[model samples]
Target: MMESQQEPKVTIPPLIPLEYSNRMMLKTILECGDDQIGLFGKTVVVGGWVKSSKEVKREPVAAALKPPTAAEAFPPSPGRKELSCVEVVQSRIPFFKKIIRVFGVSSDSYPGVREKFEPVPKPPPPPPSKFFLQISDASSISSLMVVIDSAVVPVSAGHVLPTGTCILAQGVLEKSSSHGKQTIELKVEKILHIGTVEPDTYPLSRKRLPLDSLRDYPHIRPRTTTVASITRICDTLDFAAHTFLHNHGFLHVQVPIITTIDSEGFSEKFQVTTSKKWGLGSGSDADVRHETVKAEQHIEARDKSKLGTGVKPEVKEDFFGRQSYLSVSGRLHLESYACALGNVYSFGPRFRAEKTGSIKQVAEMWVVEVEIAFSQLEDSMKCAEDCFKFLCKWILDHCPHDMKFVTKRIDKTIVHRLEYMMSISYERISYREAVDILRKVTDKTFETKLRWGVPLTAEHLSYLADDHYKRPVIIYDYPKAVKPFYVRLNDDGKTVAAFDMVVPKMGTVITGSQSEERLDMLSARMKEFDLSRDQYEWYQDLRKHGTVKHSGFRLGFDLMVLLMTTGLTDVRDVVPFPRTHGKANN
Candidate 1:
């Protein structure tokens, strides 16, 4: 009985060789040193799509091979034979080849494969004929290629597929000797539609559409190569800005968008209210009924006039018992936070109601407001320079592809320009010096003549950025009469410790200054500016309790985008759903 006991037989399958597996082979290829593969006499396999395909017949030559020329032989040749009939394959295609096997002479030689064929895989039924194929599969690396049946319907304006469609394709891959690279040509044995259609979708496609055309479709523009690339760059810049501050121990503060005061008193603000007429009335049933009656009466009176009239009948009762406006800037609030929390920054949308026809302005845009306690204008200027340099370097390093595309298409000198700006130390000069420089440039191109006390115009700033400094210039110590009341008065009494950082294309990207921390001086300045003391009681309370010398700056986020990518013509082009005066499409 013991001898009758027997074990079941087991069979083990043979292991697949690493060289035959696609992933293993791809790893090997990636690990291979550059130039290790000869230009000829090497067998290489590449996976991509057929950008274009052609068939031609020629008589096969029977002549013997000739000796290499001196030009070709100067570089000691790695022993390999060159292949004939080089082909080109565009890498822009998506999901070129999920899997491919190419055997050819000379890994560097193109059209090396004497014959090309793709192994067909069983694929699902084709989608509707209307459905276009968009392939995106990774062989081993993260590279994805997309191949569309361009012959069926050439991708053009209004006919391109919405972005975000997934597709599968079968194709042949070969090395292109003419182009000096490898490519995949989708013989397209079978195209499989693996996903449902998305309404608005796109990844990389043809050239960037104009900003004017994209304005009509803000939500979908991001799907395009240009917009996507810019978005990614903007995101990186934002990250760099925050990181530059955070790494230096600055607290990230989220300031309120709705506030009672305008930090930049020069610009008009969008009013926010809780009154029934302004759309934020809610209370008890009885109060609601009363509000409804008042609203109806007001509406009846208003309807008696023009249909598009913006005025509303004045109500005696206060809404929310206080007046508020969409903050034009968060600098004031951030100053208080900075005094309390050391150094702080606020990043958020700021709204303005000014009808600026100038190309430099937008009604609603994001801003980066930074305030540092115990810091002066000089310290703030240094911080700004460091922040700008950090942003440029971060974008170049983190968003190489996007930056490259933007530099090539949007602005040819963007990278070089930004690099030069970062490498060179910023020039610092007094406002008086800036005024003198502007006075010297008396050309017809200048829109306005420069005056000593007048606020510097965009033309003047442009001259400083483009001509005078050749880089970012920090112009400080402005005339106190033209500056905000918050700015600290300099020893000269006629000037304030304020500065504006002007870049080549964008002027006044950042404006900041040391605050008047001395209560007596601030009170006197507030009186001189004709500002109501009651309006800033809380702000003054800081001085009453514990006020420290501080300096801060406000950077228009849209302006930063324009300066970074150099594509956007106006601030509106950079912001999504822009709310410029006379145009509130969102």
Candidate 2:
């Protein structure tokens, strides 16, 4: 029998086309799944324009190949070459060419390569694996790990990857477990540059970038870990809110932003307009000016007439041919739907025009509004508590990484705070009881503030949440005079069945009450408040036909985020670009 010797099988990584490779280079090349052998420990060629460079003084090869000018520095010329100042400066360092070759391990060894690159270098240097791998999907979960090509090092926190840059990472893939799940990670051995480069326009970096600095770059903030974590948490919470309501048989309704009624009755709204200016005159500049002057004179004459004969100016001729404003809350509209749907909720942007300078005010903000028919104030309170607790639990379970990052970096006590709130029952007290408690306090500032009819301020609400309850607390039965006219009048006739949900850090994040179902009472209450009866015809119609017992609450979504994540002093921090009183930034 003759022994036969066989040659070893040779495998090669499939060559990616220039076009396909071009797209791969534009983004961070985390993994190369095929053709592992071609990249392992081989001197591959790559070429591209220098995106960045750093001087390698210790390399004898660089010292010997130094060029006098920038033009002579790269691909050294046989003779002297003229170079510009920028080129001269760029030549002294190693340029990260667009097309480069990485002579390193295969993608299979990426995990081990990443592990080997983890230890800090001598002199407390940055990680040798200059770039960090970031893999994410639309859901913001199930990220895969791959090494960032060593050539693409992040210089600063705000440094952004160029639009297009082909990168070849020769690394080994190793299996690892994170959050109790098995996953593959790439350990890069070498980075090869390819001959393609694009301009860097997106703002991002791998440093400890400040959130304040990224305010102007909302579109790109999601690339950063902090902002990415926020986005993920926000998404999870939003889903959880809807899920909680849907599971409870609450119908989701999309409320219109532009409306004819000022639901909040605060008269703060962003009026919608189609024309550049309100069309007050028929035609011509002179005619328009004459009409404007005539309108002013009419207003003066009307005021004089009011003083003499108590006459009011007719406002029907003004803009839009009617009085209208953007909705500040969707509860009123949803209330109508609630009557039909049993339980309904509206989630959308709500506009306001209050100019107070505080951490809690914004011209435009998201609101989670719920209206329940045949429910009392206590039912609304329970619903509010359940919704908040469900949201916290859902985010914590589904977005563990994001929640961990947020709690540790943004708010140290987030999880604990939520857990404590869920376990402890919220202390329920009437507004009169709260006033009595405040009056009993030794704090002299509250000595004269034991009034039964005044509305509670943030300070008072904080005292209840922080000092009296030490958890979220619900204060109900406020004086009717201080509450909205829709609130049901209590047995005392002076108070109403309204409640405010106050948390430890965020006071009064939600305000709600049961509606007065009696048509006569509601009408009289509206008249007492001097509100227009015609303005609320639709709202009154709900009571006229078959008004049932109902209750609802309005929650400031941004304020909730602020309470859950960062203890932001200004509500603007939570929103991408908040529209404040005097400023509107895109």
For each candidate, what is the lDDT?
0.65, 0.67
Q: What are the RMSD figures for all models against the true structure? A: 20.5, 16.5
lDDT of 1 by residue, 173-224 (tens): 2232233233322233334333334343432233456777777677656555
Q: Give me the candidate number with maximum lDDT.
A: 2
Give Cα distance to truth, residue 355, candidate 1, Å. 0.4
- Cα TM-score per model: 0.66, 0.66
Error of 2 at 528 (Å): 1.7
Write down the worst ten-residue block by lDDT for model 1: 48-57
In terms of lDDT, model 1 sits at 0.65
Per-residue lDDT tens digits of candidate 2, residues 99-123?
1225443545444322121222223
Quote the lDDT for 435 in model 1: 80
